[model samples]
Target: MFDVKTIGIIHTPYQQKFGVPRQPNLVPLGTGELHLIAPFNHPDCVRGLEQFSHLWLLFMFNHTAHQGWQNMVRPPRLGGNEKMGIFATRSTFRPNPIGLSAVELHDIVIQDNCTILKLGSVDLVDKTPIIDIKPYLPYSDSYPLAKASYASEKPAIMLTILFSELADQQLLLKPQLKDLIQQVIAQDPRPAYKKKSLSTQEFGITLQNANIRFKVEDDIATILSVE
Candidate 1:
């Protein structure tokens, strides 16, 4: 058996999986920080990391790992109706329960002797356990001519977001979160089945310490409140 160790934990605005972007860099406003732990927190561990503009994060699916896995899964990209081989999709349910994401590396900071890597356009949930980190080499990683069957293109921003008076007022206290909130909601965080039909059901997601509630009707997502 192979042994793995968590070098750090990533803190992102997504407190829950319900609203996290399905893929990295989908929401450019989404930002996070990786706080290295123990021996890994030393500056020598990341001596030349700052030279790279992006990095690849190898993280564990801590929340879903306990649920076990199956060989087949329904991919949200296929409207959650078609079953595909687990290896064929990016399902969190897997034998290894591992996930990989390429995120923009904004900066590396040392605060109170703790090493932290500031990241942008991340898709990881809050407090995600990171197993490993590697610099992203665009020359070898980028393949513009590559084709993805179902996810050939980036998902479209399906909904128009409108904030309520209360939400607008709350934004005054945290103006920095306004752009993040709009970008997240614009991608339409509803389930695949819900996206196939129009419903008046209200939805809520926890971003940072705020509880954002909203509803979708006729392709318009109205922010009901921010508590």
Candidate 2:
């Protein structure tokens, strides 16, 4: 049997799974921090990692615990109608529910006897357990000619997001985060089945400590409130 230990915990604005982008860098303004656990918090462990501009985070699907695996799984990008081999897609329900994300490295901070990694455009949810970290090597990682079987191109932005007076007032406390919230909503995070529905249902996403409520109607998403 192989043994893997969680080296740290990743903290992100995504307190829930509802609005998180499926892939890294998709939400350009989303930022995160990795807090190294006890023994691994030693500065010597991550020595020289700052030289790289990006890092690959290997983390476990802690939220999917106790879920059984399936040989075939549906991908959201396929409109949730088609089933593909589990290996072909990055589904959360795998034999080993481990996920990998590449994020831009911002800086490293050692404070209060803990080592923290500042990262940008992180896709992992808050409190995700990180198993390992590796520097991203562009020379070997980028494959311009490589074929992406189904996700050939990035998902298109489908909605125009507008903020209400109440939302604006709440956003005044952290105006810099407006772009991140807009980017997350523009991707239309609603489930595939709910995409074209005209129910005008208001959805809420927790960003940082604020609860943002918005509704989509006729392709326009308006922020109704933020608290």
Candidate 3:
């Protein structure tokens, strides 16, 4: 049997998965930190890691564990109208409930007796277990001619957002939080099957200790409140 150990845990503003951006770096304003566990928190462990601007994070989908996977998955980018082989899509329900994300390495610091690595544009859930961290090599990782069948082009923002008075007040208290919300909503986090449907249902997303409610209508998303 193979043994895998978690070397760290990720801390982020995202308290749940309902509103998480589907891909890493998609929400450039979102940020997080990786707190290294004992034995792995030593400075020597990351001696030359600071030279790289980005890193690859291998993490576990702890919440999705025990759910079986299928050979085919419906991709959200395809509007859930088509099926692709499991290997072609980044589906959390996999043979192994693990995820890989490329995130910007902002800095390494110590606070409150803990060593942490500050990350930017991270698409992981709060408290996600990190299995490994590796420097990202742009020379080999990037392909100028790489082609995707249906996802070749970046998705465009299709909706306009309006914040309620309560949300505006919350933004004044925490201005940095506004960018995260704007970018996430612009991407439209609804499921592929519900993208074209319309309803009066209010959707709520939790960020840090604040809750945000909004509704979508005719390609417009209006923030109802922030509490």
Candidates in order have lDDT scores of: 0.91, 0.90, 0.86
Residue 34 lDDT in candidate 3: 97
Tens digit of per-residue lDDT, candidate 3, span 88-187: 9998889999899999999999656577999998888899999999999999988879998888887888668888887887688777777778888888
Between the candidate structures 2 and 3, which one is better when assessed by lDDT?
2
In the range 1-227, model 2's lDDT, one tens digit per residue, is: 98999999999999988888999888888889999998999999999999999999999988885696899987889988899999999988889989999999999999889999999988888999999999999999989889998898988997999999888887887777788889999998999888857778788899887788999999999998888
Clashing pairs in 3: none
What is the lDDT, from 0 to 100, of the residue 83 in candidate 2? 93
Name model 2 segments beyond 4 Å from true.
none
Which run of 10 residues does model 2 get worst, by summed lDDT? 193-202
Candidates 1 and 2 compared: the better one by lDDT is 1
Clashing pairs in 2: none
How many residue pairs clash in model 2?
Answer: 0
Query: What residue pairs are clashing in model 1?
Result: none
Model 1, span 1-227: residue lDDT tens? 78899999999999999889999888887899999998899999999999999999999999899999998999988889999999999999999889999999999998788999999889989999999999999999999999888999999887899999989998987877887888999988898888877668789999887899998999899888888
Model 2: how far residue 45 lies from native, Å: 0.6
TM-score for all models, in order of appearance: 0.96, 0.95, 0.94
